[model samples]
Target: ASRTETVKSVYDKMLNSIKEKKTAPPNAWLWDFIAKCSSKEDIELLFDMLQKLRIFRLSSLRIHENFNTALCREVTKACVRVGAIEYGKKAALWRHNAFGLTPDIGSTHHLLLYSKQLNDVNLLVEVMKLVKKNELTIQAGSADIVFSICSGADRWDLMTKYGKRFVLSGIKLRQSSFDMWMEFAAKKG
Candidate 1:
C-alpha cells in the first residue's frame, strides 16, 4: 500500500503549517489527525504538540470545548495502550475533574491498577475521592484494588477499615489480602 498520509506525516504537516502561519491548527484537521492515529506513539506525539501549544497560550478555546468526553476517553485508552499508566490516570482525572465526564468501570480499574503499580497512594486516594464525591456505585472488584493499594502502601488503617468492610460487604478477600492484615495485626500486637 502506498500510504500518502501517516501519523508522522500529519504531525510534520501540522507543525510546519502552524509554524509558518502562526495560527492554531484547524479544528477539523487537528481532530482528524488525532482520530487517525494507529499507535500510542502517534497519540503521544499529538499530545506533546498540544501541550506545547497550550503552555505557550497558543491553543484555541474552540479546541478545548470541542474535546469534550470523547477526546478524554481516547487519551485514557491510548495511555493504557502505551503502558503509560501515570498518564492514563492523569487523563482519567482530567476527564472527570475538568470535563465533568462520568467515570466508567474501566477507568476505575485503570486508576486502581495504576495506583498500585505506580506505588502512588495519592492516586489511589484520588480514585476513592472521586467515587465518593460523585456518589458512584462501588463494585465488588473495588475491594481487590483497595487491598492492593493498602498492601502496597502499608496503610494498615485503611486495610483494617476496608477489610472489615469487605467482609461485611460479602466480597471474598484474596489470600494475600488476608495475609497483609494478619501481618499488620501481628505487628500491632
Candidate 2:
C-alpha cells in the first residue's frame, strides 16, 4: 500500500514492472492508485514509469469502454499539488478538444479549487476557458471558492460574473458562497 511504502520501494517495483514489460494495468486501476498515493515525488516516479512503458498520454486516456475522465481529474489534481498548473490546464484542454469529450465534473471542481487555493488567477482563468471550451457548467466546489475570493477582493465585476456562473452552473451555492455573496451585497450599498 502507498501508506506503508517508502518512495524508493514503490518506484523500484513500478520500474521493475516496466522493465519486465508487464502489460499495462487497466486505466481505472492506475488512476485510482495515483489518487491514493501521496507526494508529487512518488507520483512523478510513477509517471516516469508510465512514460517508459510508452503509455504516457498527453490527454484523453481512453480505456476499453470509454474516455477516462476520472483519471484526467486525478492527474489534474496531482499536477496542481506539484505547482504544475499550466501543464494541468493544457492537458485537460487537450483531453476535451483532442478527444471531443467533456471533462468530468469532479476534476473540474478539483482543478478550480486547487488553483484558487494556490491563488493562481492565470490558472483559474485558464480553467474557466477550458470549461467554456468544453461546454461544462461550473461545479459547486469551484464556484463557492471563486465567489469567496471575488467578494473578499471587492471585485464587484468578478463577483457578479461568478454569481451568474454559479446560477447558470445550476449547482447549489454552498453556504460559504451564499454568505460571501451576501457580505458583498451588504458592503456595496
Candidate 3:
C-alpha cells in the first residue's frame, strides 16, 4: 500500500484501540513507522497521532535535511509535551531559534551532547549553567550523559562541578566508575 494509505490504516487501528482503552501491539508498530516519516503532511499527522496516543519515546524520530522551522517547532512542542525534550535539543542543535523555548532536564542533557558534538563552548556552558542553576533536575541517566559530554568537550570544570552534583543526587556510582570519570575528566581537561 501507499504511505498515505498505510498511515491511514494505522491511524484507524490506533483510534479504535484508544476508544477501547487498550494498547494494541500494532499501534506500537505504527508509532515506530510514523517516527520515521519525512513527509511534511505525514510528519504532522504523526505528531497529531502521537499527541492522541500519548506515545512519547523520541529515540525513534529521525529529523532530516528537509525539516523546516515549523516542523521543528512542532517537534519541539511535542517533545516537551511527551517528556521527550532531549529530542528537541537535537533539533535545536541543528537549528537555533530566537524564540525562547526553555528546555527541560532531558533537553538540557541532550543540549549538552550537542554542545560537545559541535564543540560549542558557549552552548555547553549555557546548558551547564541551566543545570547548575536548578532550573532542571539531574535525573537518572543524566550522569552518563554528563560523563559523555565532559569527555567529549574536555570540560573538566563543568564535569567536576556536575559530577559532584550527580554524586549528591544519590546516583550510586561504582568507585571504579567514579575514579574513571574523574581521571577521564582530568585527562581531557
Candidate 4:
C-alpha cells in the first residue's frame, strides 16, 4: 500500500478504537502517525482524531511532560507545510493551552522558527508576548531564533528588548545569537 493509505489505515483504526471504547493505541504511536501526515487532508484527519482522543478521555492516551510539546511542534509544522499558517498558529496555541502542560520553550521555539521563515515581525512579537505571558523559560535556541527574526526585519528595537530580557533572565545565549545582535546593532548605527 502507498504511504498515504497506510497512514490513513492507522488513523482509521485509532479513531475506531476510540469510538468503540477499546484500548486505544499509545500516544507515541499516534505521534508517529502525526509525523507521517503530509497533506492538508491528513492533517485535518489528525486533528479530528486528536479531538476524539480528548473527548473520550482515553486513559491510554495520557499526555506526559514534553509529549504535548512534541505534538504541538509536529502539528504546527504539518499545518505550515499545507499553507495553513494561521491554522498552524491556532493549533499550536490550542495544544499548549488545552493540555495544561507547563509552558515549554520548545513549543514557542517552533513558532519562532516559522515566524522567521515567513519574515513576520508581527508573528514574532506575538510569540514573544506569549512567551512572556506564559512565563515560558527561554532557551538559547529560542533566543537565537528571536535574534534571527529581529535581524532579518531590521527591528533593532526588538532585538535590544529581547536581548536585555535574555540577559536579565540569566539565559546564556549562543555566540551566534550574540553575533547576530552585534551585527544588527552596528548596521543600525
Model 1, CA-based lDDT: 0.63
- Model 1, stretches more than 4 Å misplaced? 1-75, 80-101, 164-180
For each candidate, give its TM-score against the true structure: 0.50, 0.64, 0.44, 0.77
Ranking by lDDT: 4, 1, 2, 3
Best by TM-score: 4
Which residue pairs in model 1 clash with each other?
A: none
- Candidate lDDT values, in order: 0.63, 0.61, 0.54, 0.73
* Clash pairs detected, candidate 2: none
Please write out the lDDT profile of model 2 over residues 39-142, one tens digit for every residue: 65656554554454344233223332334676567666776666665545643554434332236667676776776676666666677777777766566677
TM-score order, best first, reads 4, 2, 1, 3
Cα RMSD for predicted model 3: 11.0
Q: How far in Å is the alpha carbon of 185 misplaced in model 2?
A: 2.1
RMSD of 2: 5.2
- Candidate 2 lowest-lDDT run of ten: 56-65
On lDDT, the leading prediction is 4
Report the C-alpha displacement of residue 94, candidate 4, in angstroms: 5.2
Against the true structure, candidate 2 has what lDDT?
0.61
**Alpha-carbon runs more than 4 Å astray in model 2:** 1-22, 26-67, 91-102
Residue-level lDDT of model 1, residues 52-84, one tens digit each, is 455333253334332445656665665665566
Name the Cα RMSD for model 1: 7.4
